[model samples]
Target: MRDLRARFRAAYGASGWHLLLLVGCFAVAAWVALRLAGEATAGRMLLWFVGAVVAHDLVLFPMYAAADWALRTAVRERRARPASGPSLLNHLRVPALAAALLFLVYLPGILRQGRETYLAATGQDQQPFLARWLLASGALFLASGIRYAFRRWRARRG
Candidate 1:
């Protein structure tokens, strides 16, 4: 118990300063981004940022939370009833919503028709755009998983 506590304290101390530095940098960046926006013009960029924050907090977060809660509660109720398990859409919620969020977040890049345009330009069907995007995300997930596994393995070895 003492050894575990010591290790935890060591890790915390090592991380604390780095986390504080990161947060300070992030605050400065955000301030600079907002401040750097147009002072001569109508300040459209700041307005966009404010709108995005409100939309994300008021609309997106609540919608996703309600959807997840509803699906979970329905699943629980279905377990009790045994007749109604889950709606088809409910079953698809997490994946579909995740994909939508992914696609939406990269809306500009997606619409700029990056790899999709290149594929079409090369006489390939645009259908592969979806596959390509998924492949890219899958690779990212794989990388993250590998990194996490490596970290855990190292921590255990230490």
Candidate 2:
């Protein structure tokens, strides 16, 4: 059994489950595509998809890549010379990512882009989105900071 498993792994370059999961994901994507194709708004959806890809590739990717590089450089410079403990990069990255994702998802509401539609759909004003997003971002950063401080304290105690 071990030999057969080893042979399978060697041939596949990963566990059989990986291939199964990959196929499953592709099947789900295909299902979504078929469903989208049946919709009257398929052209709009396709346009949005292409626009998102182009925006991410041409604008967002470069901006974030530069920001990440700058952040790493800044963190590396500020950190202790001996890289003995956990790095602060990931702690910063996680909160930033969460905040950015929240901002993006709530962007229309935050910007008050479609006040009438939003009001009609949810019967709520878009006035709170910006404040809520800010509060959430602050909470995420505060939580990350607390966790980092706790880890550092524990490391020092040990």
Candidate 3:
């Protein structure tokens, strides 16, 4: 395995050829997937892929990044307390991202020709993913609440 890896590294030299090969592999894989799942299904996959990429770049990442940066910056400051209060809003970094990503995955189908892949993956004719997203959001909030409650209880008991 090591010898083969070393030979491959020497030959490929990590260049455009490698990227071309990767794209070729993906093309073959996509073809196979379309064959197995049907061309209609493959077309849907393309739409979902585009929607997911757009959302991950535009929406979900920005929220998570901003919250993470804000938290880190708050900690770095010499101020006795962060200017932002220690409130539920300040700690919603993970939940907000989850909610946003969930929403984005569902949004591509809104008032437009819905992506087949999104519908297939979500198992709903319309807006089924939203129900699941809501359930997940509720779960995230419940878990957060339980953790906070437990910590408070522990502090009181001790």
- Clashes (N, CA, C under 3 Å) per candidate: 0, 0, 0
Model 1, 32-106: lDDT tens digits are 877776466537766887889998999989988897777666666544333433333333454556566777776
- Between candidates 2 and 3, which one is better according to lDDT? 2
Candidate 3: segments with Cα more than 4 A from true spot: 1-60, 67-91, 104-124
For model 3, state the Cα shift of residue 87 in Å: 10
Q: What is the Å distance of residue 48 in model 3 from its true position?
A: 12
Q: Which residue pairs in candidate 3 collide?
A: none
lDDT of 2 at 35: 88
- Candidate rank order under TM-score: 2, 3, 1
Q: List the residue pairs that clash in candidate 1.
A: none
lDDT per residue as tens, model 3, 55-94:
7799768877887777656654433234433344434555
Name model 2 segments beyond 4 Å from true. 1-47, 77-82
lDDT of 2 by residue, 113-147 (tens): 98888889999888988999999999999999899
TM-score, predicted candidate 1 vs. hidden true structure: 0.37
Looking at model 2, which ten-residue stretch has the lowest summed lDDT?
77-86
Score every model by TM-score. Answer: 0.37, 0.66, 0.39
Whole-model lDDT for model 3 versus the true structure?
Answer: 0.65
